[model samples]
Target: MTLWLCQLVTSLQSCLQNKIYDGKTLTCTQTFENPMCLTFSHHCFLPSWLFVKFDVSFIVHLWHVFLNVHIKQALNFSDTYVVHVNVFVSLQVIKVYNEDNTSRAVEVPTDITARDICQLFVLKNHCIDDHSWTLFEHLTHLSIERIIEDHESVMEVLSGWAMDTDSRLYFRKNYAKYEFFNKPLDFFPDHMVSISSETNGMMNHSQLIQTFLNSSTCPEIHGHLHAKEQGRKSWKKFYFVLRRSGLYFSNKGTSKEPRHLQFIAEFSDGDVYTLLSARKMHGAPTDYGFCVKSTKRGSPRDLKLLCADDEQTRTCWVTAMRLFKYGMQLYQNFIQPHQKQKTPMRSISENSLVAMDFSGHKSRVIENPSEALSVAVEEGLSWRVASHSLFLYVSFRLVPNEHHHGCPVCFAALHMAQPWFHSKLSRDEAHRLITQQGLIDGVFLLRDSQSNPNTFVLSLCHTQRIKHFQILPVDEEGELFYSLDDGHTRFADLIQLVEFYQLNRGVLPCKLKHHCARITL
Candidate 1:
C-alpha cells in the first residue's frame, strides 16, 4: 500500500512539473522510493479510484487534507508516531550599552523580560549573578533614566518609545534595585513613614514593608519636597503624601485633610525616574531630583518634577512608589533568584566544619557563636601577620635596597592591581563610577586624594548617595600605615583596609559588598 502511494505521489509531482493532467484513471505501476509515504500506512487509508477524475491541483489539495487528518490522528498514538511542528516566534532587536558606551545588539523574543535580558548578558559576559545586575532605560533628550523592573516586558517598554527619540537600554549593575529588601530602615526612615488615621500613627519598623504590601492598610510616606510648578521654571516647597492610591500635596501647611490634599500623580500611569543633571538641565534646587514621567507622554513638559532635600529622602519616596506600584511582585523579583538555586551554596562537608580551639594542647569545637567568631578573627589576624612577615622576607630577598623601606611601597603598589582601586581618579569621577555601577550600600571604590597626594579616598554608596572617606597616611614606629580614623585603627595597605571594612562595618555605614567595575565588551 505504501509503495502504491509513493508511486501515486511521484506521478502527481511529474504532472505538476509538466503543468499537464489528463481526465483518466491513474495507476501506480512505476516503483519509487519515498521515505515519508511509508510512515502513513497505519495512520491513513485512501481508495485508489478516488483519483481517477481529479486534476493535478485537486490531487495536491486532497493529499494535503489527508496528510493533515492522518497527522492529527497519529498524535494520539505517541508511542508509535511522532509529529514535528514549526512555530514562528516573534523576535525584537534591542541594543544594550555598557558603562563605557560600548553597545551590543541582541535579538530576543518580543515577550522577554528585563530580568531575562540581564541573565543573558550575565552568561555572555561571564559575570557573576549577584542579583545586582539591572537594566536601565536612558532617555538622552531629558537626561533621565530609570531602572527597569525585572518583570517588566522589554517589548512593552519599547512600544512606549518614539522612533525619533535617542532613548537606549543600559545593562549594568544597580545594587539598589533590591536593596530595600535588605535595609528597609535605611530606605524608609521612621520620620517619613506613618499609618493612616484609623490606627495610631506609630508603625512597626520590621513590618513597615508589610504595611505597604497590605491593601487593607494605608501606609503613607509624607515629607517636604521641592516641586517644580507646571509650565514654570521656579520651584516651591510643598508637603507631599504618597499613598497606595497616588501622590498628593497639601495646599495648606502639612495638612492631611481631604480638602487640602491635592493629587499630584499616580504610579499606575507613570514611572519614577532620576534626573542625570537636575540643576543644569531642569534648574532644580538640588541634585537629588526625581520626576514622575507619564507612560503615555515622552516629553519633559509632562513630567511631574520633584526634588528631595537629601538622597535618603529621594530614595524613600522612590522606593515607596515602587512598592505601591508593584506590591508583592517586587518582593518576588527579589527572592526569585534565590528560589532558582537548586543546590545549597555550601557543601555538606563544609557546613559540618566548625571553629576549633587548640590553645590548651587539646582541641575542642567551639560551641558558642561569639567564641567561634573570636577564634576565627584571631586565626585571620595570625594568618595576615604570617603573610605580612613572608612578604617582607620575600621583598628583602628579591630587592636588597627595599629592606629598610619596609612593605609600605610594596603595599601601595598592591592596590594598583585591585579592580576596585582607580588610582589618580578624582572624587567626582569616583562618585560617577560608583553611581553608574550601583548606588546601593557598600558599592565602593578607592582613588588617590586630589587634595593630599599622600592619602587615598574610599568612595562608598549608602542610602542611594555617594560618600568619600579619606584614608590618611599614619606613621607609627617608623612604619607607614593607612587609617580612616586618624592613627587609631591602621592597616599596612589600602587592600587590608578595604578587606577589613568588607568584613567589618566599623566606622562605615555598611560593609563593602560590591566593587565598581568596568568591562569592555
Candidate 2:
C-alpha cells in the first residue's frame, strides 16, 4: 500500500509538471504505468484541471479514494465496500413551560415519550423522583389543557397541533395523575357506576378496576351531567352514559334503551380536557367543568363541553373516560415506576448504624427486637422535645416582648423564609394555587386567614377538593403559640406546626406530602 501510494504521488507530480493550459481552461490526461490503475480507473485519473477549479482539496480527496482502493485490494475485500459512514439522527427541539409561564428549550428525539421527558427535567432540575411529575398540552387559543399520558409519544402529540395555533407544552407536578389507581372507590362512586345490571348491581371494590380492564366485560359509568349546547350559551342537564364505544346521553330521561340514547363523542378520535375558566370564559353553570376536545379541531366551538355539580363528580367522569380510552395502558403507567425500582442494596452507612442504649454508663447495642423498638421510641421522643425546646428558645430571643399582640413580627421572620408559607394570600388565591399545583391528597400551602388578620389558614386538598383549617394564635401561660386543634396541639411558631403536621396527620385529613411550589424554571 505504501509503495502504491508513493508511486501515485510521483505520477501526480509528473502530471502537474507536464500540464497543458489553454486560455479557456487547464487540461491534462496523464496515464500511469501502475497495473492497478485499470482496476480503479474511475479514481486513478490524473486530472490537472481539477486543481485549477477545486484546488488541492480535490487532489487530496482523490488520493484518499486511491488509498482506500489499495487497502481494499490488499486485504481481499469486496468491491462494494464503503469508506465513509453517513449517520442520520431524528432530533427535535421542544419548549416546555412551567406553571409560572417560564420555559426551557429541550432537544429530544422524535420517538421520546412524555415520561422520558419528565425524567429528563427531573434529573436536570435535581428534583426527587416521586413519580408525580407530569407533562401538559395547553391550547392557549381554546383556553383548554390536558394531561399528556406517560406512554404517549411527545412528537406525535406535537404533530397534531396547527402551525398557527397558540399551543404549548408544560412540565409540572400532577399528583392526581395516578391517584385513581390508589383510591378506586373514591374515583368510581357507587351511584355513578353501572356494570350492565348483572349480579344485581353488587360488585366488589377490588373488582371494580378489573371490570374496566377486561375486554369481555362491559363496565358503564352513568350519571347526570350538564352539557353546553353547540353554538349557544345555554346548557341543559341530561343523563349521560359512558361506555367503551363512546359517550351517549338519554334523550328520554335516564332511559338506557337504544332508541332513547344519543351518541355524543368517541374516545378514539379525541381527548378529555379540564377547562381553565369555567364560569368566566365558557359560561359554565358551576366551576367543576371538563370537556371532550376533538384532536382535529382547535376551536372552542367544536368542544363537547360538560359541567359537573362538584369536583368529585367531574373527577369521576374524567377518570372513567381515561380508563375507557387507554384501558390497561393507564394501569401499566401507574406501576411502571414501581417496576423499575430494583431491590435496594444495603449501604455501608446503614450497616454501620446500630440501635444503641446509652442510658447506662456504657453504651451497648440493643440486640433484642423489643429493646430496640423501646430505644427507638425513646430516642424519637427525646429528639422531638429537644427540637421543640430549641425552637421555643429561638422564638423567645426573636420576640422578647411575648405580650405584643400575637407575635406578628417573629412569625413573619420565621415562616416567610419557608417555601410552603404564602403570607397574606386570600382564600380564593390559595385554592387556585393548590388546584394549579395538584389536587392530590396531601398537597398544601399556608396562608393568612382572610377573615381574621392575626390568624393563619392551612389550605389543603384531601379528595379532589381544597379544604381550609384556621391556625389560631393561642395564649398559653402568657406565651404565644400556634395551634390547629383549638389549643390541644401548640407550637412556638408556624414552621414547627407545618413540620409536625407533615409527619403526623393530627387534625388534617392527610399528611402534608407536597407543598405548592412556584419555581422559576
Candidate 3:
C-alpha cells in the first residue's frame, strides 16, 4: 500500500511541475496569468523567476505603447482646437468716393440713394422739400426697415433732414409715397385735442369769428412788444372795445359784421392788462359807444375819465368807417373793373334771363323748348369765371360734338361730347378719339349727380389761356365768403387753398397757418 501511494504522489508532482512552467495553460485556467508560477520550477526556480520578471516588464511596456498611441493624440487635438470663428467685414466696399478732381477715399453715407451716389458733378445743396428735389427721384425707394438696420453707418452720407444733400429715406418706390417728417418729441395728448376742435370748427368760439374789422381801415402795425416802465408813465393802459353799433351788414354777402364786441386792454408797457367785452342783441338796433374809465388805490368811486366826449368818439368812428368804405369802393371800381375786362366773368342765377346776346333770337321763339333748354343747361353746366357765379357744377356730360349726331350741343358747351342715344362706340373708339383730338387736358364741368338744386349757376372765366381755378364758400344768406384756390397752385397761398381743398373732400385741413406757428387754443 505504501509503494502504490508513493507512485501516485510522483505522478501528481510531475503534473503540478508541468502546469507551473506552461504559461499558455496557466492563462487558460485563470483570468490572470500567474507571474510567480514559472518561478516555482522544481529544478531551476531562481533562474525561472528572471524570465517571469522579463514577461512583466514586456506587458508594462505594451500598456505604455497603447497609451502613447491614443492619449497623446487626444492631448494634441485639445491643444490645436477652436470652437468658434471670427471674420472682419470689408470696409472698402462701404466707403464713398467724392467726385473730386482728387482721388481721396471719401466716406460714403450708408443712407445714400442710388440717385445721390450717381451724380457726376458737385451741386449746391437745397432742402429735401425744395422744388429742386425732383433731381433725386430714386430716393423714393428707401424703406424704414433698411434705414433702421443700417442706422449706425448711414450718418456720413447726407447733410441731414431738410438739407439738399438729404433725400427721403423711408418711402416705398411704388404707390402711396409718404415722406417722414419729424414730429414733436414730447407729445401732450390733451394739447392735440385742443387743436382738433379748432380745426374741425367745433369749438365754441369759432362761430363768433367774423370779418368785422375791415383790413383796409386798420393801419397795419408790427407785432406788439412788452417793455417795462422806467420813469413816470403818461397813460396806465389803452383798451379797445368791439361794440354792437359798429355792426352793419353789407349789400354783398362778401362783407361780414359781428353782433357782439370783444374788448382788449394793454398797459403802457405793452403787456396785456385784461379782456373786457359784452355781447347784446335785443332784436333792436342798439347804438352805443365804448366807455373808458380809470381807478385809483381804494377809492369808493372806482373810475375817473381821462377823456370823455361822445361826439368826438363818434367822429373818430366815422372817419375809420369812411376809410373802409373808400377802400371797398376803390377795390370795386378800379380793381374789379380791370379784373372784369381782363377775363370774362359769367354769373348764373337760379332764374336765367333768356337774353338776345348769344342766341340769334328766332322770331317768336321758334319751337323745341327742350332743345333750347338743353343749350341753356349746357351753359349752366360749363366752367365759367368767378365774376360769372360762385357755384361749382360737376357733370359727366359736357360739350357736344361736330356730328350733331352724338349730343353735339354737349360737345360745344363742355368741350366734350357724349355719344348720341342711337350711336354705338367701339371698345377703344372713345379713348382713341379723345387722345387723338388732343382734348385730354380740356376742362369740362362734371355733373354732380349728388346735387338737388334744379336751377343752378355756371361761372366761367379764361385769362391768357393759363387757367387757374378757385372755389368760394358762402353762408346761408351769402354774406360770408371764404375762398380757396384750386390744386394747381404753389405754396404761395398754401393755408387758404388747403382749407378749401379739405372742405371739398369732406375733411379738415390742419389749422397751422405756417409751419412756424402753433395751432392756437
What TM value does model 3 have?
0.14
Candidate 3 lDDT by residue in tens digits, 63-95: 233333333253353533321211111112222
Question: Considering summed lDDT, which 10 consecutive residues are worst modelled in model 1?
Answer: 19-28
In model 2, the Cα lDDT at residue 243 comes to 90
Supply candidate 2's per-residue lDDT for 97.
95
Instruction: Score candidate 2 by lDDT.
Output: 0.78
TM-score against truth, every candidate: 0.72, 0.76, 0.14
Best-first order by lDDT:
2, 1, 3
lDDT scores for all predictions?
A: 0.77, 0.78, 0.25
39-154 in candidate 1: lDDT tens per residue?
Answer: 32221122222232233245556555444444455334444333332222245678999887999887666667888888778866777888888899999989999999999988
Task: Give the C-alpha miss distance for residue 432 in model 3, angstroms.
Answer: 31
Pairs of colliding residues, candidate 2: none
Best by lDDT: 2
